[model samples]
Target: MKKEKVVLAYSGGLDTSVILTWLKETYGYDVIAVCVNVGQEDDFEEVKKKALATGAVDAYAVDVVEEFITEYIYPTLKAGAVYEDDYLLGTSFARPLIAKKLVEIAEKEGAVAIAHGATGKGNDQVRFEATIKALNPRLKIIAPWRIWSLKSREDCIDYAQKHNIPITVTKNKIYSRDQNIWHISHEGGNLENPWNEHDESIYMMSVAPQDAPDEPTYIEIEFEKGIPVKINGEKYDPVTMLTILNKIAGENGVGTIDIIENRLVGMKSRGIYETPGGTVLFKAHKALEKLTLDRDTLSFKKIVAEKYAQLVYDGLWYTPLREALSKFVDHTQECVTGKVKMKLYKGNCVAVASVSPYSLYNEEFVTFGEDDVYNQKDAEGFINLFALPLTIRAIMNEKKIKEEKEVI
Candidate 1:
């Protein structure tokens, strides 16, 4: 009897490893394990071997590093979309791309369904299923976490041990982590208790501010239309620049954030993020925009940025609103070409100077001592008109109070 084929979004983690075996034994499905690498460090060979040994009919590891950065990270960066002001949208952005590949593999291999190890409680489940539904509605989604009677990681481990499966999870160190080129997120474990201070050792991309060097590191970034093109006067591609910046910023103990955020799953989830490269990219880009963008555009874009961040965080990546917002953002970046000099010290990214060809800052007009433009006396008329409504309201309030006292 030929069993139905199911392609899984496999990561060689404890949950997925157990899932691979469970799908075969419990459901009688021919499992095809597809691991998509988006810059997270893993031994692909060992992952593949484990998948094969754990009852997967076929195992494959796909490298999507360059594409991950170029297509996903760069576009998000261009939009300046940071989720909840701290997250660089690492996990959220990677989820859709991985789901797309799973859909492709399912179509290519004639698989009847696709599965993911994301638990029913988490946001990844929503992100993955949403992408799958948008990209390929015909393909069925088998979310084992929702259906399986095995309640916890402990149950999964017990199943693995009973089935002679290799297991790595232990009770002592049980943090759920997601990593990519943009950032590494640490959750679970002691993070559930908001009072528990995060152990600094768990962080990978950045060092603790208390341990940062006494001396500061300074760097200059050159942007071509809001896309960082050079560091220290040397031009490099997007990925390469990010790689370089990550090394430099991480060494200096920068870009670590601890926050309690409202999850898309209607829960308050606490996390610590290490985003060395992303922090540098955002800081430099902001400094460049100060030089390039006009006051009104810059102010308006802040509102757009807040909405954009919320949309991305909520995993509305494929919606028309997000697409429309992106179009407006891309327009703002047209003249966002510039160079910004910044100083990094003890987790602080400080902008020292910035210059752009399209700079709206006119020093001659802004200087207080002497200027041909921006006459100081013109402000008297401007202030009068601006305050007229407020003055009228105050007078009316006084008249109303006097009338009330007379009636009393």
Candidate 2:
């Protein structure tokens, strides 16, 4: 009898590689490994080879970098959704896209189940399972960490050795990492201990702030309706633009954040994120919005931004709420076209100048000197009317005080 097919979200890493073999050996299933590449630094051919060697009947490597940026990253960027005001939601957003690919491949391959290597303790487990269930509810989801006896990374290492699985991770260097075009995240190992300061060596995409060059790097970014279009006057496609900016900003140590974030699993997990290009894009986009958006719209959108970040972080990317939020965010981006000049120095990405065609700032109205656009005498009446309620309250209080003295 043929075994039921399971499409495993394979990364050729320690956990997934071990899962590839363990799933087949334990469940007696024909494993089809699928690896979705979202601009991570990995050799896909090697990954496929490892999957096949680890007892997977077939393996696939899908490149979704362009789709990831244009579809997922751009919307979140437009919303300015930063998780807890620090995390850029890099790993959070990538999981949905990867899970989406898993569903597609599972359907195409006629697989009955989808498997993921995400541990039960982390947010990725929720992210993957939630996206999978949202997209294809019928498919049976198998999460190895939640079930299997392998409880720790050390156990995974022992299993890999016993199964002859090739893995790069060792006990000495055991920081669990996830990487993509937007950013790279480091967790596990010393990060689990909040008292342990992250070693500079763990940073992959960016230099340490202290190690950055003395001279600052200035760059001009141009956006078209909140989507980044050009860098320093040269237009680039999404992939190329991000790649260029990541290198430049990483060199300047532009984005490295260490935070203890609340996980969707109701636990506090500490992680270090490196988001060089994303940092630059977000700062530049915010600067453009400041110049173009009115005070009320900008203020209200901040509330929307917090909710949007929460949705993305919780892996509700496929829900109607996220779609609705995206529509709202897109509507707000109509005038978010402009050029922003940013200064990058030692992990700081500051927008120094911004200009937009729809800029609401008026030099004549805001100038301290005399201007024809406004009359100084008009302020007296405006202030009087604005302060009328306060003045009335004070007069009433005085009358009450005088009446109380007479009564006494």
Best by TM-score: 2
List the candidates' TM-scores in order: 0.95, 0.98
Query: Can you write out model 2's per-residue Cα lDDT over 161-201, one digit (the tens) per residue?
Result: 99788999999889899999999999989788999999998
Minimum summed lDDT over a 10-residue window in model 1 is located at 70-79
- Residue lDDT tens for model 1, 99-183: 8889999999999999999998889999899889988999999999999999987788788789888877776777888988778
Residue 280, model 2: Cα distance from true site in angstroms: 0.6
Candidate 1 overall lDDT versus native: 0.86
Candidate 1 similarity to native, TM-score: 0.95
Provide the clash count, candidate 1: 0
Candidate 1 wrongly placed segments (more than 4 Å): 395-408
Error of 1 at 188 (Å): 1.3
